[model samples]
Target: MRTVYSEDHRLHDGKHELLEGQFMKVHESPSRADIVIGRVRSAGLGEIIAPQEFGLEPILKVHDEGLVRFLENAWDDWAATGRTFDALPHVWPVPGLSRGALGRRLSDCIDGKLGYYAIDAGTPIMSGTWAAVRASANVALTAQKLVATGEKSAFALCRPPGHHAGSDFYGGYCFLNNAGIAAQAFRDQGARRIAILDVDYHHGNGTQQMFYERGDVLTISLHADPEQEFPYFIGYADEIGAGAGEGYHMNLPLPWGTDWQGYSAALDRAMKRIEQYGAEALIVSLGLDTFEHDPISRFKLAEADYQRLGQRIAWADLPTLFVMEGGYAVEALGVNTVNVLMGFEQR
Candidate 1:
């Protein structure tokens, strides 16, 4: 598989994020991509190409204009107040406050806008965030282009992982929803039916929300159950889509402490759904945080199991695009991530 990468990912490095009622060093750092790229080279996994600039047009296809504009200017806006630290939201526009007139006025203040556009406090915005996220989206789009144009498979090594971001809100260390953008790119490029299989330890709430009302792109996620995971909302078994998209979306939420046996069973069911969907192409939101040693996530998947995961994905027999999502066990990220690609290639 050819891998699409970008040096710009290093630009978005953040100092700290609010987690568990305390500020801590960000887990979604540049090293995650650094190690994965190193392994791809060491394993000789075909070509490693820089991403082509797809620009904001493709991103706007899935994300809100206000959210994109906020990300693009957030650091500068925050810095204008003389705060040099990374920008993190201190407050959120909860349900009632968000729907009332207060939400409209909040958009004018940088502090208020931070909460207005963000879903959680974990994602910090620094000066280089916009550039990094833009490059990340380009990486995903480049890989999607490869698969849409006839490459058997490609890897979009995106950073500031995007599964948790929705069309109008950003969180879970994600800014632009790369997988959602890529799936839309596939549609724009003429694939009639597309399937996105998210194997992240956390649910892909953003990707699901983007396609939940559309029938063309089938979104399936196998992740830690929402009741027990981060982004503790949505991603239930019953959120099977709405309106024209009813029955088009599927969420197989697994419990905490799930290991290879349980994960593999969910993968089998997801694969079966893709077969039934008759999808013209497939996009895998490849997140290795399910690994046994990952800090923030709670699954127990071992390194070897990733290969089996990849092999199962291969059995789907569609042109595939793997978009990197989350994996914080930086030391072992390379092995677990490459194991999946290696398995897919071998299969």
Candidate 2:
């Protein structure tokens, strides 16, 4: 598997993120990508290629235009206010707040816009956010193109991981949905049926929302149950796609402390669903955060277990593109992540 990466990912490096009622160092650090890439090289996991310059055109297909424009200008807009130390939203327009009635356009206040577009306060915007985010999307798109052109499998080592961001909302340290964008690009390129298997520790709410109303792309995610997880909203097994997408969407929520035995059972079920769907291609929202020591994650799959995870994925035997997502155990991130890719190859 050829791994696609970008040094430009360092651009979106943040200082701190608001979590657990205090601002602490961001877990989604540049070193996370560095460690993973270094492991890829150390393990000789194929050549590492730079991503092609796919501009916002492909991204716009999976995101809202105004949201895109907002992300583009968010940093500078916040900086203009002269209180910049890593911009985080302080307020949100949720539910019955009359302040939310400032109209659907969102008030001109930059703070309000930040909250309006953001799903949580944990994803802070830095100076290089937009540039880095665009680059990350390009990386995913490039990998998808390679798989479509007949590469057996490709890994998009995207940073500031996506999957948390919906069409107009960004959070969970995700600025854009890389897996979502790639799946849509696959459809645009005439892939009749493609399935996204998001094995991240967190639910791919954004990816689910993007395809929840469509049947062309089947989206499935196995993650920490929403009731007890960070997103704390969707991801229930009951959210089986809507309308034309009915039964096309699936969510297998696992409890905290789930080990390999528990995880594999869910993986088996997910693979079976994809097989039944008869997908031509697969987009694995690869996240190694479910590791036993992941800082903010709860699953307990150990290091060697990742290889088994990948081997199982290889069983599906479909053209696959692995788009990097969450996994905050920076030290072990590489070993676990590359293990999955290598496992798939060895199979």
Candidate 3:
């Protein structure tokens, strides 16, 4: 499998994020990609290439213009206020607030804009955030192009992992919704239908929201139950898409301590669904955070289990593009992530 990577991902490195009532070192660090790429090299996973600059046109397909513009200028806007620290949102326009025309006026301030477009405070904006996020999206697009052409599979080693971002909001350490962008790219490149299988420990709330009302792309995620995990609002079995997308989206919310036995069952069901849907291509939101020792996630998938996970995904028998997502167990990240690719190749 060819792997698409970008050094620009290091540019968006953040210092701290608000978590557990206090600001602490961010878990979504630059080293996450560094470690994963290192493993890919050591394991002889295949060629590692730089991403082609697809520009903002491909990104605008799934992200909102306002959100994109905000990310591009957020750091400078915040810096103008005389603060050099990482920018985190302090407030949000919650349920009762006016999200209409007046809300647009409220976002005139940098702080208000941060709150206006962010879902949580964990994702911090730094000076290089825009560059890094743009590069990350390009990484995903390059890999998608590879599969769309002729490659059997490709890995988009994206950073600031994008499964948590929505069309107009950014959070969960994500900014551009890389997988959603790639899935949309597949659609734009003439694929009649695409399936995105999210194996991240956390639900792909952003990806779900992007494709929830569309039937062309089938999004299936197997993650920790939202009630017991982050992004506690959606990702339930009940959210099986809407309108034209009805019966196309599926959420397999597992429990916190779920092991391979439980996870594999869900994977089996997801594969069956993909087969039934007759997708032309597949995109795996590959997140290694489901590992047993991940710091910020809960799941009992062991290192060796990742190979099995990969094999099962390969069984789906569709052209696949694996877009990197969450995984905070820094030391073991590479091995676990490559295990999936290696397994796919072996299959």
Candidate 4:
């Protein structure tokens, strides 16, 4: 497995995030990536490579144009209002909000645009966010290119992790759906079927929404049940794909406090479904936040559990691209993450 990484990830680190009841320290931090990188090196997983500069073409393929434009200009627009704090959204257009009756929803207000385009208030837009986010997408795209050329497996160590952003919205500290974009690129480059296995602690609401109506791409996510998790709107097992996409989507909603025994059982079922689907390539939305030590999550997986996780993934026997997602246990992040990659390698 070749690991793609970049130090620029540290640039987008936020000062604080709202958690529990008050603004505690941000669980999503730069140190999380550092720990993962350290574990990759300490385990001698594989050679680490820098991502290629794949410009905007690949990104525009999956994200909405107006959304991209908003992300690129969000920081500058916020700054122009003479507000120097990190920008977070507070209001949103839910049910009776009267859509399609607008010509610029915000009153030239960055705050309103922030809420309009975002789903939660946790993800903040900082000065270096645009640059870091674009770079993170490049890392995932570069890894996909490697897999397309026949690499058995590749790891995209993306930061400010993606999987929560949809075509026109961004949240869950995700600005771009890296795994979603890669799966689409795989489709564009001759792959007949692509399956995304999102093993993150949180449901890949954005990725599911992105491909929910398409049959060409199959998405399976095993996460903390939406009933007890953030982004608590989607990710139910009942959300089997719509229309032509029926039977192509799967959601294994595990309860909080699920240990490896419980986690692996759901994983086995997810893998079996993928095998039955006969996908040509695999994209793993690898998130270690399920670790018992993870600050914000509730699963009880340990470091060694990742080794088992990796071995099980290898059983699927498909060319895989591991795209980094959530994991907030800063100290154990690397050990848990690299264990999965190394476990796959050893298998």
**What C-alpha RMSD separates each model from the true structure?**
1.3, 1.4, 1.2, 1.5
On lDDT, the candidate that comes out on top is: 3
State the weakest 10-residue window (summed lDDT) of model 4.
98-107
TM per candidate: 0.98, 0.98, 0.98, 0.97
Encode model 3's per-residue lDDT on 201-313: one tens digit a residue: 99999999999999999999999999998899999999999999999999999998999999999999999999999999999999999999999887999999999999988
Question: Over the stretch 1-347, how does candidate 1's per-residue lDDT look in tens digits?
Answer: 99999999999999998888888999999999999999999999989999898779999988889889888989999999999999988877775666667444456889899988888888889989999999999999999988888899999999978988999889999998999999999888888999999999999999988889999999999999999888888999999999989999999999989999999988999999999999999999999999999999899999999999989999988999999999999999999999999999874
Which scores greater on TM-score, model 1 or model 4?
1
Q: lDDT, candidate 2, residue 286?
A: 94
Candidate 2's TM-score reads 0.98
Clashes of 3: 0
Stretches of candidate 2 off by over 4 Å are 99-105
What is the C-alpha local distance difference test score of candidate 2?
0.92
RMSD of 4: 1.5
Record all residue pairs in model 4 with backbone atoms less than 3 Å apart, i.e. clashing.
Answer: none
Task: Compose the digit string of candidate 4's lDDT tens values, residues 156-244.
Answer: 99998999999889999999999998998999999999999999999999999999999999999999999989889999989999998
Tell how far residue 30 is off in model 2, in angstroms.
0.3
The order by descending lDDT is: 3, 2, 1, 4
Cα deviation in Å at residue 58, candidate 3? Answer: 0.8
lDDT value, residue 43 of candidate 3: 86
Clashing pairs in 3: none
